[model samples]
Target: MTSPHSKLHISRSLNRFQTQITIFLPRVAVSKMTVVHIVLIKFRPGVAQEHKDTVIQELNKMKEMDCVKHHRLVVGTSITVPVERSKGFEIALVSFHENAIELDKYRNSEEHLRITTTHIYPHQEESIRFDFEVAPEEEHLWTFLPIPAEN
Candidate 1:
């Protein structure tokens, strides 16, 4: 039979072990807030249809990235104004990851590099990227633009 003192000691050890386990387990706490990233991509002018298709296909794959909270791709139409006329960037906007870290991951992602090098660079006459940080209040504004449907 175990002595009372020994039993008490064993109980203490088990409690400590349980506490350690609880402390180390990953928590699922939600982020109180998030950052926003507005990415503007200018593709090379006069890019071939095949190249554009490939780039779009690669960009569409970004939706599958774990770090991407939201993703949207917009092509510049005649109504859109170029940020720089000399460079001739056909506008494209990519919205992803509300966190800067996640955005960094996205920038360094293999898929992103692959798309740029394989499809964008080969067909692009010139390309540029712009990144903007957005506040919580301004988040909805990005999606608030009015556009008429084309026939």
Candidate 2:
């Protein structure tokens, strides 16, 4: 079963390319319009750090796309602790979009292809991508409810 609070909020994205508004019925259905996109990358042997930085720079350019949420696309090197758990993946990107449609636009954009094919894939030994819909926080659900007096 899904949480009720998830149905109380919807995502709206207004931009030069597209404007979208999604609605959810209160307490009965949830909107899955918000999307989180993540990518983890490991470069091949002898790939210079300088090249990696260039890749990150190109990835950051994705924020200019109107489909990206709040310019939330971020790219950085991993600071994972017990570093062994990272399995040699050194670079990562986390981005948010209003919906899957926006995500699709981002994926198919020319900039993404240029960056990946020209800069990323040549040195990319291993890469993983994960995308998912956002869920409402449990704490926010209690915000408007009355609290009983202390017993």
Candidate 3:
């Protein structure tokens, strides 16, 4: 859902061809509208370091895909932050797409399927994913809440 606080506006401009065909979107939603995908993964016991490295390498390729607007992979850094519960997951993947269509493209892409099925899933014991839409300036608000499969 889009933010009620946001507004959509359209404007027209002349191009070099002197044609009157231009659409200008709202600065807030158009510039900041995004769908976010966050995945938390826990590797099974005794999973080798090489396997984990392969996951990171493969996940990095998602960033190079056209559908992804931004991507980041990070390892859990703290066990002492008592207020923050991670469910013992060790790795996280964060990605953003311009909209749901772009996100769906990324989800079904061959590059994603190849890595997760071949490299990462075999080593993981459990995984959690959260997908949400974030409107401009609504960082504290989430569109949906659930713990689902990372795929």
Q: Sort by TM-score, best first: what order?
A: 2, 3, 1
Give the runs in model 1 whose Cα sits over 4 Å from its true position: 1-46, 72-87, 143-151
Q: Tell me which of candidates 1 and 3 scores higher on TM-score.
A: 3
Candidate 2 per-residue lDDT over residues 1-151, each given as its tens digit: 7655433222323233443445454443425557889999999999999999999899999998998977778899989898989999999998888787689778866677678888888898999999988765642432344658898
RMSD of 2: 12.1
| Winning model by lDDT | 2
**Shift of residue 26 alpha carbon in model 2, Å:** 26
In lDDT terms, how accurate is model 1?
A: 0.55
Q: Which numbered prediction scores highest in TM-score against the true structure?
A: 2
Return the lDDT, model 2, position 7: 32
For residues 1-151, write the lDDT of model 3, one tens digit per residue. 7634533232322233322324343444333568888888888999987878778777877788888874433334225466347666877888878787678668766677677778778888998889888876785463345659898
Order of all candidates by lDDT, from best down to worst?
A: 2, 3, 1
Per residue, candidate 1 scores C-alpha lDDT tens digits across 30-140 of 343444544444555556666666666667777777777655434432234453553444536465575665776676666666666666667666555666566677667
lDDT of candidate 3?
A: 0.68
TM-score of each: 0.55, 0.69, 0.61
Give the deviation of candidate 1 from the true structure as CA RMSD.
Answer: 14.4
Q: lDDT of each prediction vs. the true structure?
A: 0.55, 0.78, 0.68
